[model samples]
Target: MAETLDILVIGGGINGTGIARDAAGRGLKVLLCEKADLAAATSSASSKLIHGGLRYLEYYEFGLVRKALIERETLLAAAPHIIKPMRFVLPHHRGLRPALLLRLGLFLYDHLGGRKVLPASKGLNLNRHPAGTPLKDEFTRGFEYSDCWVDDARLVVLNALDARERGAEILTRTTCAGARRNGGIWDVELQQADGSRKTYKTRALVNAAGPWVADVLNQVSPHSAKNKRMRLIKGSHIIVDKLFDGDHAYIFQNADGRIIFAIPYQDHFTLIGTTDVAYQGDLDTVSASDEETRYICAAASDYFKRAVVPADVRGTYSGVRPLYDDGSEDAASVTRDYVLNLDTADGAAPLLSVFGGKITTYRKLAEHVMSELQPLLGFSLKPWTARMALPGGDIPNADFDGFCGEMSTRYAWLPQPLLMRLLQAYGTRVDRLLGKAADTADLGEDFGGGLYEAELTYLKDTEWATCAEDVLWRRSKLGLHLPAAAHKKVADWFAKATEIAA
Candidate 1:
């Protein structure tokens, strides 16, 4: 019998990492395993907003919206560097939803979660507002509302880092192969990327496998048919050259009643997307189909003065959302709220399966998971993540701009753009990467566009970044900014680094 762990988390996405961090902070021995790199899937492929789902109001999901709205401020304060306030422009379509209804909805949105830090939504005259410049000339009226943008992939990594710091084992490139009851504990088998097998005993198991939630239940708890209910909805997004000149994002309402966002992405591009379609294909090979790409481009063209075509699309990404099947046939109508299934059948070791959670509500979902398992796990520690900051989020009072000023003074020799990028990605931890270096030459080989060997080494060492994509796309959006030739250089560097380490 191996040493028993208090809990074992069987995913490395946002929900899984959040649970691992929460459990570890509550003084529980925890282990988290991911089949690939952290946030390599749905977690990284999100719309990257921390706001309450404004469109969800149509579904009468007031509670879910309120919870997420409250989390917007909670997450902003917790990680100011990576999460900050942004204004969303909702231009009114004369024949669609009326201005009064929009105002009422925005009113509820503003007050629903006790908003304190973010300003309230207000009416806008598109002709006068700066956000109106890119909009079609007909869009004379609009509404500006508040939301926060997050580095979704980095958020997952930060949680994993905090979990590791608090004594949880975070195993990337490791899959949870199987699990079975062994007296009062679970004998769990894990398969590493290198084909090695290891087993551990855990009192509780958490199946936060995202899109593969059903697969996990079927593999481990096949007898429990109740746990195998989920609907996979594929959402796709497209990135194009900068469509608008300002930082504000546009929320355009479609004739079909669905809304799409066109937001500033990576400073040099615009990100527009997300078409909801019932997904029934291989989860591992999900990508933006030509239809989805056209749909998003058309959606953007509907609102902007300038037209967006297939040729303008610079990149595309897609993910399958594993939503709880609430007997809804329409994929877009499916609920985004989460459901937790805890199986303690006939005194067997406990297993908790998670389904249908959004990124904005991951922390709350994690805290709720702990509450459900507190009695079974025999832990009485109070919840602490609500107030605690993630790694590099410890700036005084969460003042990100002030901290950036301080960093600029300290790294006066570094270029402003480069310094700002470091402060945004690593926050106060930038010092750890720069160390005692005094100039750009000490940072080592430049992979162009501010990517240097020093930053890559920090990612490989501290963040478990294993590949070029892991560092370029997920860790940072530098992949979009770097030239085509730079990718090979980055990949070669990673290969050489791995060889030396091995």
Candidate 2:
């Protein structure tokens, strides 16, 4: 007989992990299975900002904007090690929407979220303000607002970790090949990485497969009769050298009714993105085209004195936004808000399918999802996740600065730069990774950039990391810094190590 679970969540992305974590914490037995590595899909491919998406206001996404803004501090508090506050500068253009309109939007973004932790929006005279130093002189005015930056992949892992700690089982590299509702129980068949198959029976099934939601309904649970559609829009990003000196990011108002983000990333590079184009290609093969590269570079060059062109880009990635198709003709105008379709067909087990969601709103989406499942769980669910901390996030009121100072003092033998890197990546858990190491040699071999053997081992051993790409690309952006030869060496080493271990 297959093992029975209270809930079975497919897809190891943020929403799946978040829902699994929340359900498990509420005393429900949960099993989460991912077709690939956690966050190997669209979760890690995000623009990596936890912003409220000020541009969405133009589409009147007030509810989404407010929920996302409120979740910013909440997420920071939940996972301080991987998330933090960031400021964005929006330069004023005379031909574009008036400054008054921009200011009003900022005003609404500030007040809508009941924001107490992040600072409010401030108007800036771009000619003299420090944020304007990098911008062209023609942009005489601008505005700055607060948002949060997150390691999207790590957030999913952390949520999965918390879920596991709360008695949830996370199955990475496992695919849900089949699911059927049978007599108030979901009979699920899974295909694991090593060619092993297992069946599971669960009271409920959650289809959190971001881009593959339709595929799941049609293939995984074919019996379901829910009418839902996913609008596939391709959003691409390019990582280039940091063009500005300040910590602030720049939000450019594009002429085609799209807003592009040039965010500070990795302390050495800038992350620029995202063109919304209607895509109908294979989800796994989404790549940033040459045209997309030129488009993004043009957007970046519009506000900066330094020119951005095709050659300046060092890395590129693309993700398919499985936006809930609301019949919007413009690809950029499609709503990012999510929807939960609960299915309890005739007299069978329930299937909860998740539609569209953003990196900023996954937590609340999870909360709402599970709340809808409260009646099925047969309990008066008390909300328990609001103020709780996720793993290493318990760093003294989420004070990242104070935590860094303490870490430096404790690891005085370590170089300041290396220690800072550790604190940024692992936060309070750096000590656990350090164990009894006393010097730089204890960190193991150096593989160029900020990557060390010790950290790589920690990631592989703990975070379900199985490949060099998972380490360099998704886990960290060091892939861009490592030369071709060094990159090949690391990739070769990882493959050899995995083989030997197997």
Candidate 3:
């Protein structure tokens, strides 16, 4: 007899993990399966901002903006260590939007979600403000507004970690091969990484496979709805040597009426991004094309004092957003709002497909998903995730600075730079990762770039890290800073560890 589950979620991206966390918190039997490492796709490739989509205001997406704005504070309160408030400096362009219109948009953005916690937007004399130093002399004025910067990949992992701690089974490298309805139950076939397969019965199935949402409905569940469509819009970003000296990020306006941001990244680099191109290419092999690279460079060059060119790019990444197609001719104009498609008949097992969503609103999306499933699953729908801290997010009153001060005092033996990095990555969980280590030597083998054996082992045992990429890329961006030889050492370590376990 196959094991029965109250809910089976397909996808390890933010939505799937978030839904799994919410369902598990509600005391339901749940399991979430991912074909690859968590956040290996679109979720990790985001612009890493928790904003209300200020550009969406031009499209008259007020409701979406309001919802996202509301979620901004909620998410910041939930995970202060991973999500920090950021101020954006948008320079006024005489050739683009007028100062009055910019002011109006910023005003609306400030009040749309009942502004609190973050300061309100204000006009800036860029010629005098510190943010003006990196801009071309022509720009004399700008506006500053509050949003947030986030560790996109870490956000996905934290949700999965919370779900696992709450008794939900999160199976990475496990694919949902197929699912079929057996009366009021769903028989789900999952294929593991080692080529073994298992079938489980689930009372409901959720399709949160991100870019593969449509493929899952069509190929994995042949009987599912066929009316929906997905628009695969590829957004690409580039990393370069630090463009400016300040902590503030710049939102540059282009003649094409699009905006690109140049944000301070990893202390030594600037992250610039995002070209919205309609994509028909392979999803798994997505990369920033030369054309997209040039476009982003040109966009950033327009506002910065120094010109950004393709040669200056240190690294690049791209992801395909699985937007719910709404027949919009332009890809950028497509709705960022999500649509939940519920397909079921005659009280049979329900299949819920999530289409189109942003990272800022993921928690609310999970709450909405549970509300849709509450009556059918007979679980207590009283929402609990809104106030609950995700895993290590529970710092007293959400004061990350205070938490850091306390940790610094407690772990005085650890290097200050390494301690800060660990606290930013693991939050209060650093205590567990550090264990009883009294000094740097106690941290075990140094894998260069401050990555130690103790941290690697914790990642393997708790975070479902299976390989070097999982450790260096998704779990942490240490790959960007680590020496080339350190990469091989990490891989060899993982190989030996796996062999030992086997």
Clash pairs detected, candidate 3: none
TM-score for all predictions? Answer: 0.99, 0.96, 0.99
Residue 242 of model 2: what lDDT?
83
**Evaluation by lDDT, superior candidate among 1 and 2:** 1
The Cα error of candidate 2 at residue 160, in Å, is 1.2
Greater TM-score among 2 and 3 belongs to 3
Model 3 lDDT tens row, 1-502: 6568999999999999999999999889999999999999999999999999999999999999999999998898889889999999999999999999999999999999997899999999988999999889999999999999999999999999999989999999999888888999999999999999999999999999999998899975566544367899999999999989978898988887788989999999999988889998888899999999999999999888899999999999999999989898988889989889887767889899999999998998999999999889888759998888877899999999999999999999988999999999999899999999998899899998899999999999999998999999888889889888999999999999999999
Error of 2 at 494 (Å): 3.0
* Model 2 bad stretches (over 4 Å): 223-228
Alpha carbon deviation, residue 277, candidate 3 (Å): 0.9
Question: Candidate 2 lDDT, tens digit per residue, 386-419?
Answer: 8898877889988989988888788999888778
lDDT of each prediction vs. the true structure? 0.93, 0.86, 0.92
Sort all candidates by TM-score, best to worst.
1, 3, 2
Q: Which candidate gets the maximum lDDT versus the true structure?
A: 1
> Which 10-residue window in model 3 sums to the lowest lDDT?
219-228
